[model samples]
Target: MMMKTIKYASLFRSEAKKVHRSKRWKPIFNEPLPIEVTGSTQYQGLAPFDFVVALLQDGQSLPSYFYVHPLTLPRKTRANIARALNKSVNEVQCLELHFDGHNGDHLLVYSSDDDANILYLIAIGTHSDIFG
Candidate 1:
């Protein structure tokens, strides 16, 4: 009787390939929207920027509600952000993202109402750094 031995590495590789292929097989959003920084110096030249971009790209295949969380900012904070962005307060609905690899850092963003395909990065910082 002959016994066949399975190669674990090959099996793992094949499974990984399947997962990768599936990720690229279909996109939830027909197209990924463009992202723009709203001139907030808080997140400039930071790791969170790269993380957010990747999230936006990968999130195209999944509903944003699955990963992106809605934020309810204080009336004062909303006014502040609106003033900085030169946008009306009513137009600023913030979203929060606690990305990996950045301990305690939060990424804040909002999508443009006029252009749904455009995303605006509002801020990136810890709880105090953002709200305080």
Candidate 2:
């Protein structure tokens, strides 16, 4: 199966800037959004990467669309996040993170493949740890 690359990483900076610039920045939901899915087209689950993009893009409608799934950040996004956290990209294996669709405090737990049980959590966007 060919994997289609999602460009959410590149958009992260811009989205962050928008969020930082305006306290009242609301996402426009009028545009049709693209969401990725797994398995048969008819029977599929939400793609984690796509879901993150949707969250970063517009979160107003997340309750209707986003869900808890195994989310893997793309290579580019992983690298970007590593840089943001001041971590060495090679030492960080953070492609996978969890979003329960109800929490605003998204925890990005990065596990180092070189070492087991070594986890780092970087909080992004808004919300506290509601998943716990």
Candidate 3:
């Protein structure tokens, strides 16, 4: 799969500024959380990237295009994530974006234990690729 690191801060700031100027609304988060895309092939396209941009622009509203919920993983998977993040299983609670019945691309993310505002983008792929 293709992999690349994205510095989302600049992107988010520009987008947020546009939203603020257009809508005269402040962003929900005081600061945009750091975003890291660990792995993905489809993410090379603009659809997912634009979706994320819109999500940020909306400022924390639960839109129909995505769902924010806890991720349930196997014991081994949980342990691996915990080890990698240097966090306990309980502290490793994850949230994901479920795009409306389109490409089945799952965006896995988790907040940093040290800083709740820091978000880590773990993976983006099909169900099998991400959880299988």
Give RMSD to native, each candidate.
20.6, 13.9, 14.4
| lDDT (C-alpha, whole model) for all candidates | 0.44, 0.38, 0.44
Q: Indicate the residue-level lDDT of 123 in model 3.
A: 53
Whole-model lDDT, model 2: 0.38
What would the per-residue lDDT of candidate 1 be over residues 1-132, giving only the tens digit for each residue? 122221122222443344335533222112222333213333234343343454443333222423466788788877865664557889777776654323424334443322333344555434554566
Error of 2 at 20 (Å): 13
CA shift at 114, candidate 2, in angstroms?
Answer: 20
Clashing pairs in 2: none
The best-first sequence of candidates by TM-score reads: 3, 1, 2
| Residues 12-110, model 2: lDDT tens digits | 444445444544323211222233323243213434434444333332223333443344556776687567445676655543333433442333333
Prediction 1 TM-score vs. true: 0.40
- The 10-residue segment of model 1 with minimum total lDDT is 1-10
lDDT of 3: 0.44
Ranking 1 against 3 by TM-score, winner: 3
